[model samples]
Target: MIAEYADRVWRGESDDSIVDQGMEGKGVKPIVDGVGWWSGFGNVVAFEGSGELALFDTSSPFSAAQLHADVRAWSSAPLTAAFYSHGHIDHVFGTGPFEESRRATIYAHEAVAARFERYVLTSGYNAVINQRQFQAPGLRWPVEYRHPDVTYRDSLTVRQAGVTFDLFHAKGETDDATVAYVPEHRLLLPGDLFIWVTPNCGNPQKVQRYPREWVHALHRMAALDAEIMLPSHGAPIFGRDRIRQALLETAEWLESLVTQTLDLLNAGARLDEIVHTVTPPEHLADRPYLRARYDEPEFVVRNLWRLYGGWYDGNPANLKPAPDAVLATAVADLAGGAARLADAALDALSRGDERLAGHLAEMAALAAPTDAGVHRVRAQVFSTRAANEQSLMAKGVFTWVSSESSAHANRLGAPE
Candidate 1:
């Protein structure tokens, strides 16, 4: 898979250079005595002499057959147990591979069970729309949800192979998030709570996230005095002080969002106004860990609104809506033909007005996807804008759009 990813990059077939660089030659390495986030998506913690192994968060991409092959490269320790930090598909779906190797008991929060059940019921609906959300083809939600054999509500302590593993449940990026702490090793495995780049408590295209609760969860994890913090995504933090600083900063960032949202709501400001006004502090904004790579602050505010209020975004016009295509056609007709709108969008791009250019270019793409000139202009504009974007959320969205435009241009036989 890594080779295939590299080949795609070399062939100029994909724009995932960052991901490719991160994964290149980065096979699993042991942390402390036994803990490791394997070459794949999960982590493994083994007991030194007992050959006892505990796995955390099995990932997809590789089926059971493939995972078995990969696991052999690591230790041949007998799998004792599997712990799911959350009910997310990436964290649990690959457990089938481990289950086949040994009779591993699965442990997770009780809420994880409910989450799995919900996924089973809504898998079809989730599969259909997931591609659009992540801009990936064949992104399907798994229907086969393996329930946890052991479930806990708040906390659970398990001692195996002379090492004590502490599991603490807290609602963070996911409703069923669990943080595993090994006091003996001073290692903290905080699933998605600290996903390296950002907390991901505000995924714009996904389900609701609990930002306030995530902030509280981070604070709690920071207070644990753990020396090493390993996250579900990205690299690990080794020092106690560094881990504490990261967690504290992330909490402060989320707290700022929560406080700003409440202040605006109390001031009777509308949703759009609040979103425009409430900017995260510069210190938080400058931090690499807090970058909005996957989720933005606006989405966090929206999630808070859903948690405190309801689905309605306090906008009466958005309470109900006509079919999107019908409304889009009407809007296109009002702005004249899509080509004319696209020409105007090009003019906006020329005038260094990216905000307006982005809006118009999007409209042009939706309105006249077949137009070669529209696709070219949209690609160029979005690419330039993406290069200048500071926020990862904006960068990802724009880069995806740019890629889409380039794909369309290729389909139309336009020159690169």
Candidate 2:
């Protein structure tokens, strides 16, 4: 059943919802002779070794118990060690459950420890941003983390039960990412490196993503020529040719963005101009792995600009701009009133100019902070914008903004 589902997903016949079904503890199914894969929001791949089991990832806190139970069901052998793909909350939380029987030595990139430290330092901020990002108001950031016991800088090779596991470090979605290769099995565990979506190099609410470094990592993985690939978030890929095409094409997609962005930046173009101009390679648009369902290419362009050029955005007036409210009030007065601005916003929305509508609606609300009528229009503008977007990142942010205005509209009784 999983194989058929995986094939459908690979062919782009299945939607993202199928991949995001939220971990029913699908149980550990055999990948090869001795390896077992437990599919979840965060997949855990267990390797049966000399009277013990080694895991690729431990999964999130929510799925910890189920992950343990499912893996235990597959194998009674105790977990001897585990490899963390990265320090993301989802991939590092399940070890505690397994540690009850016997503590498993964890191995990861050295930067994973620093990532945990930063998570602790910004726990509250992380919680709030994540709540907005995922639309989970009740979401709480985990203060506690399972730090890796063994850390490596570049690469580490571990031989357990006659199986060789080679770990390599790279920066992509996170600063601390580990890509593992098992030679005997001819398997590649890419972690989130190849999540079957457009590389998430442009998360608006999160930290910096290394597109250039990520491209390098993808290229490196492609060169490995692994026959079977198991990603942290998506279905496994079979055959060397299929795996090679996915990895290399993904690398090309990111490299296209990086090259285009750098060309514009080197040409002394403003970020606004560069963002509007730099485009993903047209040839690769139809590739199933290159779709921008989770993170769009435009966001990646913005992230590249921020990486090379500072936050100035090449707009002189924006460098020391007036407060948003102050600017909005001036514009509102020029347009006659805040109601006029709100009307213009609605007109923009009706014309299918959501980008313009968003700007006008925001200015209208800022100009008349207490006007429920303006807030009503603002709500409609953002909700419509949210509906039009494809990527979850844009949808989440737009939906959150709409909800904010919606609360005001409800509280003030909507101008009636």
State which candidate has the highest lDDT: 2
- lDDT at position 204, candidate 1: 62
TM-score between candidate 1 and the true structure:
0.83
lDDT of 2 at 111: 95
Name the lDDT value of residue 393 in candidate 1: 60
Worst 10 residues of 2 by lDDT: 15-24
Enumerate residue pairs that collide in model 1. none
Per-candidate TM equals 0.83, 0.97
lDDT of each: 0.72, 0.88
Candidate 2 lDDT for residue 120 = 93
Give me the displacement of residue 328 in model 1, in angstroms.
4.5
Candidate 2 lDDT, 1-416, residue by residue in tens: 66666677678787433135432456887888789888887888889878878999888998998998888888888888999999988899998878986888899999998889999999999999988888999999998888888999999998764478899999999889999999998999999998888998899999999999999999899999998898888778888888999999999899999999999899999989988888888998887778787898899999988888878988999999999999999999999999999999999999999999999999999999889999999999999999998888998999999999999998988864
Model 2 spans > 4 angstroms off: 16-25
The segments of candidate 1 whose C-alpha lies over 4 angstroms from its true place after superposition are: 1-25, 37-49, 61-71, 128-130, 133-135, 321-334, 364-416
